[model samples]
Target: MTLLEQLGIKHPFLLAPMAGVSTPELAAEVSNQGGLGSLGLGASTASSAREQILKTQELTDQPFQVNFFCHQPAVLDAQIAQQWIDYLSPQFQKYGATPPEQLNCIYPSFLDNDDFLNVVLETQPKAVSFHFGIPHAHQIQALKAAGILTLVSATNLAEALAIEAAGIDVIIAQGIEAGGHRGIFNETFDSSVRTADLVQLIKKHCQLPIVAAGGIMTGQQAKVLLNLGADALQLGTAFVQCKSSNANIAYRKALFDQPITQITASISGRPARGLINHWHMQIDTPERPQVPAYPYTYDLGKQLHAAAVQHNDHGFGAFWAGSNVAQIRELEAADLINQLVLEMNFA
Candidate 1:
């Protein structure tokens, strides 16, 4: 079967697996509308992930994909975590909450996370995907053995080649314009290639089916990529305001009302694009310590964010978004998919 046929999607539109935003309701709605919906399993626990998959199944019999972060094992340095906590003490004080003495990493270990894998093997979802890095060879083989198609996020030609070589079924060519985290595996994210350029380069070097992502908000942008030979389009920010999404009111409003700016390794120690906020501004200070890698840094940030939210402070949260955030509209997921299809058809 062709990529679209194998995934049981009528249109070439796939919902991007957005951490903290895309919910099972949203995924099911898109899948029910004949588009491929995605569940982001990066931040969720095994039980939560299983529940989410079952919920999506209950909502829609149509096919959908589940995504996880195939992250490297976090090396936690107690001293380094303490330094980060100290750095944010002032902010904690401002919120009338004391920062924890020692920070705790709340993220699950992907290397040891068999929960999602076990869920996949048992439930046998139509498809699965990964960001940060590709899964181990045995894991990939096992998923294939279960007839589950796999997808991988690639930020450059080299990464795209690697995913193709790893025998993944499809490549999500994430451009620099993508929201949330950059998915470059080897090279530092500072060297991220733009989406248009990366798509062309990957198309030149690999024969795998490609799904173009990054800053894709409008039907016109989708058309531009389709014209460039992309087999499909994966979108994130476009669906942020979808009624089925789990984005908080503050987050949705921020995306629609504010102008997005590039913040380098402020919230997370990697180049990420999002709405500029008070926490991001703090990272610009010369006195701030270096941010820890991924889940560790992400965990500390979450603690501070929870404290801030308790006091109704929205500025400290990780309100991740893409460059085309302005185009987001408050509509139901099914309605949004209908609009996108109409736009794509008209274009």
Candidate 2:
């Protein structure tokens, strides 16, 4: 079935989920305008997730996806984690704040999270997506039983094959240039594939429908991937500049004003594509070999970022963006989606 037919939307374009960034208003506005809207539930609690899903449902009857992180629970390295904290001490002192007394795992993988599963079973969004890794059979079955369409990200062909074997409905071919998290199962995987190449690689091995992602910043780029066999396109950075997004002024200005970018593991202890900032520059280096794991290191990163922001410094913020960030424009969510569609000549 066509992506639009399955999702009941006019455009095949999607508002990709961005944790700590995408809001219900942004997702709803895009869905209302005939694009798939999404909420990043990777960092949300079971109760808070339900509230966000319910709120999103209230705004639009269109199908919207709820995304979760299915990564393994972070392994706490007490000594290593402390080293990471100490490394950021100077940055913290610069803003007159100190790191947390201790770092704690802020988020758990959804693979075996009962509360997360129960929330999905109770307030099932039309679709659910997983990142970092695919869930077990039982969880997949539960989501299927709840009538939720399933999607998962694959940075490489190996992950794509696994997603198909696990009975997933769609594969988001997340390329190296994509903003935010890398979604690689192994944090150390050599994932340097581009968006189009990754799409072709997945197509070569899998028949499951593909949603091309990564730094696709324009309709021309989207068209290239769709022509290459992508059923649709999932976009994150493109929506970051929209009026409906939750990006603060600092984040917005940084996306445009800051030109340098990098894939740093320092921000959240995961390799994610974001604009280069003081935090990444000061902390993410060759000498800084390891930090804590995914959600554990985020506690320290956020601490310093929050402290800096309070002192009117924006450089410490996590301003995630794709390499195509230069094309970003200020527009309403619906308007932005509309422009992309018009540029693609689908309007």
Candidate 3:
């Protein structure tokens, strides 16, 4: 069956769930329009996840996906975290502020959050997806028992094989051009295999459905991936400029203006693609200090942003986007989906 048939959605596209950018309203509108919408719960607490899920349910009876980060929890290091704070003190001073006295881990990893699992089980969204890594076998079984269709992102064939072996329902074949955190298992990136290549690679070895993601901004691009063996497409940057997204003015402006783009780990201590802003420029140098893992480094980065925003500067914010963000349009979510459908049909 087609993915849309399985999900009972009208379109063959899925909104790439962005943890901070996605909203229940956006997800609802997309799902209501016959494409699957997703709520990213990677950074959310169990309580917030419940609230968001309930809210999305309120907005649409159509199926929507919920996404989580299944990565290992950040290992807190007081010395290194302090060093990070010290390293960014100057930038903090630029906005007349000081970094938090101590960095704190903001979000709990799903691997460690039983409450989140319970929330998922109780809420029972039609689809559940993971990034960074897959959940445990028992967790997977539980989710399946609850009738949730499972998906996980795989950047390379090895990761794709792992996902298939783990009995996942669908594989999100994420390419190097995909924005935000990559779904690589080891967090070490080898950008040689891009989206289309990865999609073909995964299709050759695994029978699981493949959802192609990367710099897919237009319908023609989506058609190419579909022709290359992708069962569906997941678009992140293309939806950021939508009215339902949470992208701020600075991020929207940066997308519209086409700032220098690069992949940097300074913002979140993970290789995420975004506009090259002051934050990236300052920390992407070879001489930059080693950042603490995953979310530990993310803490201070947010603090720096809070300070910068006080002075009307948002270059410190995490304005993540794919390589094709330069072509984003400022349309509503439903309209963008309709246009993409038209483009794909013509292509």
Query: lDDT-based ranking, best first?
Result: 3, 2, 1
Worst 10-residue lDDT window for candidate 2 reads 278-287
Cα error of candidate 3 at position 196, Å: 0.8
Against the true structure, candidate 2 has what lDDT?
Answer: 0.86
Model 1 RMSD, rounded to 1 decimal: 1.6
lDDT of 1 by residue, 1-347 (tens): 67799889998889999878878899998999988999988888888888899999999999999998887776777777778878888888888988877655666645565777888888778999998889988889899999999999998787788899999999999988888888867524555777888788888889988899998877778888888878889988888787778989998888878857565565765567788888667666777777767667776677788889999988887788887787777777778778877888788
Query: Taking the tens digit of each residue's C-alpha lDDT, what string does model 3 give over 16-108?
Result: 999999999999999998899999999998999999999999999999999999888666777877777788888888888977888777877
lDDT by candidate, in order shown: 0.82, 0.86, 0.88
TM-score for every candidate vs. truth?
Answer: 0.95, 0.97, 0.97
List runs of model 3 lying over 4 Å from the truth.
189-192
> Pick by lDDT: which candidate is best?
3
Q: On residues 297-325, what C-alpha lDDT tens digit does candidate 2 reach at each position?
A: 88888878788878888887888998888
Error of 3 at 342 (Å): 0.6
1 or 3, greater by lDDT: 3
Q: Which stretches of candidate 1 lie over 4 Å from their true place?
A: none
